[model samples]
Target: MIVAAVPRFRHIVAEVWRPLAALFVWDVAVTIVYYRLPFHAPELPLTLFGTALALFLGFRSNSAYQRWWEGRTLWGAMINASRSLARAARNFLPEPHAHDLKRTIVLRQIAYANALRCQLRRQPVDAQVLRFLSHGEAEPALARTNIANGLVDGTGRRIADAVRAGWLDTIQQTQLESVLVDIANAQGGMERLKNTPLPAQYRFFPTLFTHMFCVLLPIGLVETLGFATPLGSTVAGLMFLAVLRIGDDLVDPFANTVHDVPLSAMCRTIEIDLLQAIGDSAPEPLQPVKGVLW
Candidate 1:
């Protein structure tokens, strides 16, 4: 969600302040131990441990950022797909949909997007989408299938009916169906990410390595650095901890939080834009709160 990096130290302090505080306590313990110890530093292999921890943290953070970036790009594709699908539906015929019929299907598609975003979050379909249904209709539509699956089926049915009514050609129906497939595929891909968690061992490695170095850092610094052992260990330990937690923060793409995929905002944008196309005068744009869109 935050594409551009802000100040690095500020970012780290904000995200991992608790862990940093814990590490500060850790540093105090190490400082006390050093004052009472008989032996410490260079020969204790501090350089090797620090270098290795740094490399691991860098690699882990980069990999997690890549996953987050890829998810964002896919959602960008979904935005474009939503707009294109609406256009295809409205204009595939000789004339665009009349103000009324066009509004219904367009609203339906908007409902579909909102429902799909909510489904990804594992939340109930939002009222924006639910308002389109009565209680009797809602139960059956949502019974077995996921919101995305149901919405796609409804879209297919609408397109098929349009063909039957001689409003859209067979080719136009097929073309419209193809657009739905792309949207369906995007939803499925996000669902797959939700279903398939990051490998436990893969995530564990960086965390384990970072903590391991932090635990060892004070002992290594004790002999040469004395009271400064705490200072050095705290600095190094907090850095590793900060980066490791940052990696963990981005691993899940569909927790529906603002940082995850911006699914709700993107879906709402789809709704507003498509409503505009259908000539709905009541498009209400929802703004992201505190730079986060839920």
Candidate 2:
């Protein structure tokens, strides 16, 4: 979400000013409290602690990014599945039914995109969803607790109806049904990442570690470089602050931020792609600043 070309230090201050400021105040307080205590390096393992913190945050960032990328890739696969679904319909339906079915399925595929973005962002599916399905279909589609899953189920139901109508051969029905399963799995995976929060322990440790490090760093430097304690503390605080904010920003990639996944833009892309598959001219590409999609 952090796309600005600004220095990371500046970006950190911008994204995490409040927390970093609080850490600064806390650092001063710690320095005062521990002033009476003689500076004892004690072969104090500051470097070891710093290394551990770095590793912990790196691992955390990697895990969070994996979830974000997985969600994006899942939607990419859904786009493919939707197009493939259309192709599969044309393969089996009688000529008259096939064209309508293709539109129906493809339009519904577009609805699925909007519904999913809304679902992920905790927004309601809007009138755009109705652009694809009739009121009878739309009502039931929106009634389910999970709009994304509901739309996915609707796709499967359409295929089932086709099988009942004798439009699709059994093997073809199964093949398309498998696609539905993959779509459902993608939704489930997104939901899993969304609902299952980052481990509380992981978040807690770095936060504690960062604060403790910044709080002690001044003293460690003070013995070697007198009267520069405040400046030294400020520098150490900024470094830890930058690292912490970067980790925090990446921690929840689904959260709405410059850094969060651009689900709305992605859903729009699916809409355009589905329309193209149906022979509609594609709309102009979206323009974004800082190389980021909305």
Which stretches of model 1 miss by more than 4 angstroms?
3-15, 40-42, 93-101, 126-128, 132-140, 282-284
For model 1, where is the 10-residue window of minimal lDDT? 93-102
- What TM-score would candidate 2 get against the native? 0.84
Which stretches of model 2 miss by more than 4 angstroms? 2-11, 23-45
| Per-residue lDDT over 1-294 for candidate 1, one digit per residue giving the tens place of the 0 to 100 score | 543435345656777778667776877787786567654444567788778778877877787777777777778778888888878867864455443445556766777777777776778774656676555444545664686677668767767877887788888877888888888788777777667767787687877777777777777777667778778778777767877887777777677644587776777788777877756664576665655555
Colliding pairs, model 2: 1-258, 1-259
Clashing pairs in 1: 40-223
Error of 2 at 63 (Å): 2.6
Tell me model 2's lDDT, rounded to 2 decimals: 0.71
Q: lDDT of each model, Cα atoms only?
A: 0.71, 0.71
Q: Per-candidate TM vs. native?
A: 0.87, 0.84
Best-fitting candidate, measured by TM-score? 1
- For each of the candidates, give the backbone clash count: 1, 2
Q: How much does each candidate deviate from the true structure in C-alpha RMSD?
A: 2.8, 3.2
